[model samples]
Target: MSRRWLSAVVGSLLALLLVPIAQAADTNLGDLSLSSSNWAEDSGNFPGIWDLTQGDMTISFTYDGNGLVDASGAHAWAELGVRSLHSGGFNFNPNSRYTYNTTTFDLRAEGSSTDVGDVTVSSDETNIYVKFVVNSGSNCTIARTRVQAGSSVSGFPRTWWGDAVPSRFNHQTIHSPQVIEYVYTISRSEVGDGDVYVAANAQIYCDTQRNPRSRIVRTCIDAWAGGVPFSRIGDTRYAIYDSSATRVDGSGVWFASDYDWTAGTFGPDPAGSPSLDIDDKFTISRFGGHAEGDYNLPQTPPDPWNNTHFWFDRDDVDQWQAAMWGMAPGVSYNTNGIYHVVITLHATSATAGTAYMTVNGASQGFYSNGWKDAEPEIYPAGMTFTGDMQQLQVFYGLLGYGATHSVTFSDITIGQ
Candidate 1:
């Protein structure tokens, strides 16, 4: 072989060796376009949508008294508050649904802008899980998102009266729409027509009561795409909600604990005597700080989220107030076995977001987007996670005076 050719080959080999390895990661966005069949009756109430439309799966909107505007798309910063959606047919997914891959429509915020409205729709699938990525531009909010799935005459999740598969996930407690993941389970036998109503940011999405931390940011819809029968989310993944049964130590509120917030075969640090455990739910609130109970939790602890004397569902924006509400004196400790807590936060802002856990009042790590390998990841489904903590904690102003009201914990996993 020629010396020049040999030298070039050696150089190429070194370059290839130096290339960095890329681990799996996911981008938090959905790509949806608007339909072209833009047609609204002169009254603007009843319209016709045969073709034209354009928008994204996650839409950011701004709605003033005039109407709603697209804050992030082509119409971004464009006020079309008076616009709306129209259609003929509909689908019946209770959690969510989407237009056919071929179908598309545009949001026409034109005349007759009402704070409340609906979009033309129909069922394309069953048990559909839907979530609208909502963002605010104007200080005010009016953007709303709704869907018309079929009716239900038998009644299951709700009363049986509607003609088609009925819907769930509506905030019966509040009218303000939320940045929530809605799960609609439509029985194939009860298939029919339906549509939805979605307002922009303020009125349409989740409204934080002056504080984002105290707010319920999102809801979840467990998936059955992996050749599995649909069942309650708790029966499937560790991503289920926090329930009472999951509480092994603290009853109503969260408190500092001595257990390790990290996941492992042995469980949090020393695998302390007092721990939080859950065979059903995921979130856990245990006593730490003193391990003996009622002190300021471990200082400069191993877990970061444990920094505050209180630990809880990511939703509990204010833990210090627990003192005002009587947090310190009445606290109790678990005498059973060493319990470990993995507090996860579902970042409502991103589609595939993150959360974390706390140990001895310290911030630990993050709950990564549930993606194991292009698939929704699981936090080591087994008897224990004697490895690392998959839970997390936020440094947002949530713990201090400057923090807005917010709900931090998304889910928790308690185990030995």
Candidate 2:
């Protein structure tokens, strides 16, 4: 893609279409971000203009399944969106990841990031407010603001690797190779969570494609904004775009934040079910890890759904299996599994490395697969975990039983 072409993508990505909100940016942003659960239920029609600093928002990039699905999992378009950079590494597999921000995966490309837009920002001691239009018309690159520093730009415990600053990374989003993305951030840059930074209708226009151009679009310039290569956790990287930290979706969006793996929140799309249905939440737990926060799970109806997790080596299929109850209609599925879940160590001496589960007290299972319904999963038996079990466990959906189980357990169990 040519530079001028990138201008179009960038320009289109920056198009800020102000939504009419009954409320303004004066409210607490902590309460403004849209409910990740309902991100898709509204069909991208935000009730009002987004109020980022006020709280969370209902993103509009419109993922059929939201980033909650892993890179190799199903997508809003009926395939794996993106793989987990931490495990899959950044292969630039267009269908994988979305964007990058240290704290979490930001899903607010809800607006456009097209040519020169308007942005309103607020700052304080730690975070800053950034509201801009995103429209990638001609600029082959897409997106902004993600913690890309392999370490921390200035010791600001990043949610992901990849830095968020050093100008080069910041600019790469506008002019970099397809395999690299600079995601470092400014050191000690305090941003207010209340006020908002407005950058509306101010970016260049470019075609929005997570992958390369299918056709020759002269106006689209594939540049640094194309994202960089995925970095290994131990690499001392610089001057290169860290695909691992880069969210790869090219929809013109204005404001974005972390993906909140703990909540497994992809956007504002309500699940066919809700968190109240622990088994139904299997997808959520499968999509993310402990965000290290106290996020309440939303309440919803229960569904007898369990994902596949069985030991292939086991000759006797006695009672070992992890399959979702296939009774509900209209819900998506895969042979492998779907949804990434996150769990916090509410009680345990388990090391950070102890974050997986096993079958029949033998073969172990990994969480990097995201969630899928492909291959027809058969969950293993005698499911054991790497750490002590507790009620604090969180996941996208219960990979266990979908029977009429109660939140109140009859006894306690633990395994290693």
Worst 10 residues of 2 by lDDT: 391-400
Q: How do the residues 1-416 of candidate 1 rate in per-residue lDDT, one tens digit apiece?
A: 99999999999999999999974342212211122112211111112221101211111111111111212221111100011111111110011112231111222222223222222222333432223222234222323333322243222232233211113423222334433322233343443324222211112432335476585443222111111112332211101111111101211112221222233312222322323321111122221122212211222223323222233221111333433321232121121221233333222221122223333223322223421212112222111111011111111001111111111211222211
Which candidate leads the pack in lDDT? 2
Point out the worst 10-residue segment of candidate 1 by lDDT. 75-84
Question: What tens-digit string does per-residue lDDT give for candidate 2 at 1-416?
Answer: 99999998877766743444465332211111112221222112112222122232221111112223322222221111112222112211212233323221211222222222222332223333233333333243333333222222343322266422224332224323332122323332332222221111111334445557466443432111211222444222222222223333221111111222223332222444222112122211112331111111221112212233221210111121223332122222221222221111121222111122221122212222444444323322111112111111110111112111111111112111
Clashes of each: 116, 220
Model 2 residue 210 distance off true place after TM-score fit, in angstroms: 19
Q: Please identify model 1 stretches exceeding 4 Å from their true place.
A: 26-187, 191-356, 359-416
What is each predicted model's overall lDDT from 0 to 1?
0.23, 0.24
Q: How many backbone clashes does candidate 2 have?
A: 220
